[model samples]
Target: MMRLIFAAMSGALFGAGLLISGMTDPARVQGWLDIFGDWDPTLGFVMAGAILPMAVAWRIAARRAVSFTGRALPTPPNPVIDRNLVTGAVLFGLGWGIAGLCPGPAMASLGFGGLPFAVFFLSMAAGMILFGLWNRR
Candidate 1:
C-alpha cells in the first residue's frame, strides 16, 4: 500500500513538474534544442533543478542500509557502451530532432489531445516494441 501510494505521488509530481516547466510542449523543447537558431536556456535550468534533488537523494540512498521498507535497494549494474548504444543514441537524437518529443514529455503532452502527438507517441511505441523484439532474438 505504501509503495503504491509512493508510486502515484511520484508520478503526479513528475507530471506536475513537466507541466510547470513547460516541458509538456514540444515547441518549448524544440526551441531549447535549437541552439543555432533562437535558443532557449530555460530547459537547462529546469533539468539542473530536477537533477540536484535526484543527486542528493542518490547520495543518501548510497549511504543508507535499507529504505523505509526493510527490502534492500537494488543497485543497477553498469552497462557497457557498445555499437548498439551509439546507434540507439543517434536514432534517438534523429527522432527528437524530427518530432521534438522524447518519451516522458510526449506522454505528458497527451493530456492536451492532438493528432501530431498521437502519431509521434504511437510511432515511438511501435519503435520500442520493435527494438524489444529484435533484442530478444
Candidate 2:
C-alpha cells in the first residue's frame, strides 16, 4: 500500500515537473531541436537539471541492495553497442525530431493536449505494438 502510494506520488511529481519545465509543449521541444534556425537551449538546460538529481539517485541506488519499496534493485545497463541499439536510437531520435514529443512528455501532455495528443498517443501505441510483433518474430 505504501509502495503503491509512493509510486503514484512519484509519477505525479514527474508529470508536474514535465509540465512546469515546458517539456509538455511540443513547440518548445521542436524549438530546442532546431539548431540551425531559431534554436532554443531550454531543452538542454532542462536535461542538465534532470541529470543532476538522477545522477545522485543513481549513486544512491548503486549503494542499495534493494529499493525502499523492498524490491530488488535493477541491474546495471548492458555495455554492448549492437546494431539493434543503434537502430533503435536512430528511430527514436527521428521520431522525437519529427514529432517533438518524447514518450514521457507525450503521455503527460495527453491531459491538457486535446485531439492532437490523443492522435499522437494512438499512433505511438500502434508503433509500439508493431515493433513488438516484429521483434517477436
Candidate 3:
C-alpha cells in the first residue's frame, strides 16, 4: 500500500514536471529537433535538469544497502553497447522526429485529449504489443 502510494505520487510529480517544462507539447519537441531550422534548446536544458536529480538519486541508491521495497537493487552485470542498442536508438530517434512525441511526454499529453496525441499513443501501444508478439515467436 505504501509502495503504491509512493509510486502514484512519483508519477504525478513526473507528469507535473513534464507539463511545467513544456515537454508535453509536441511542437516544442519538434522545434528542439529542428537543428537546421529554428532550433530550440529549451528541451535540452529541461533534460539536463531532469537527469541531474536522477543521477544523484541513482548514486545515493547505489550506495544504500537496500531499497524501500526491502530488496537489494541488482547492479547491471554487463553494460556493453551492442548493435541492437544502436538500432533501437536509431529507430527511437526516427520515430521522435516523425511523431514529435516520445513515450513519456506522449502519455502525459493525453490529458489534453487532442487527436494527434491520441493517435500517437494508440500507435505507440500497438507497436509495443506487436513487438512483444513477434519476440514471443
Cα RMSD for candidates in order: 1.6, 1.0, 1.3
Question: Clash number for model 2?
Answer: 0
Query: What ranking of all candidate models by lDDT puts the best one first?
Result: 2, 3, 1
How does each model score on lDDT?
Answer: 0.86, 0.92, 0.89
Candidate 3 residues 1-137, lDDT tens each?
Answer: 88899899999998999999988887888999999999999999998999999889888888888887877876755789899889988999999998788998889989894898999999999999998999899
Candidate 1 weakest ten by summed lDDT: 69-78
Instruction: Compose the digit string of candidate 1's lDDT tens values, residues 1-137.
Output: 88889888988899889989978777888899999999999999999999999889888888888887666876765688899889989999888877778888888878784898888889999999998999899
Candidate 2 per-residue lDDT, tens place, 1-137, comes to 99889989989999999999988898999999999999989989899999999999999999999998789988989999999999999999998989889999989999889998999899999999999999899
Clashes of 1: 0
RMSD of 1: 1.6
Question: Global lDDT for candidate 3?
Answer: 0.89
Number of the top-ranking candidate, with lDDT as the measure? 2
What's the TM-score of every candidate structure? 0.91, 0.95, 0.93
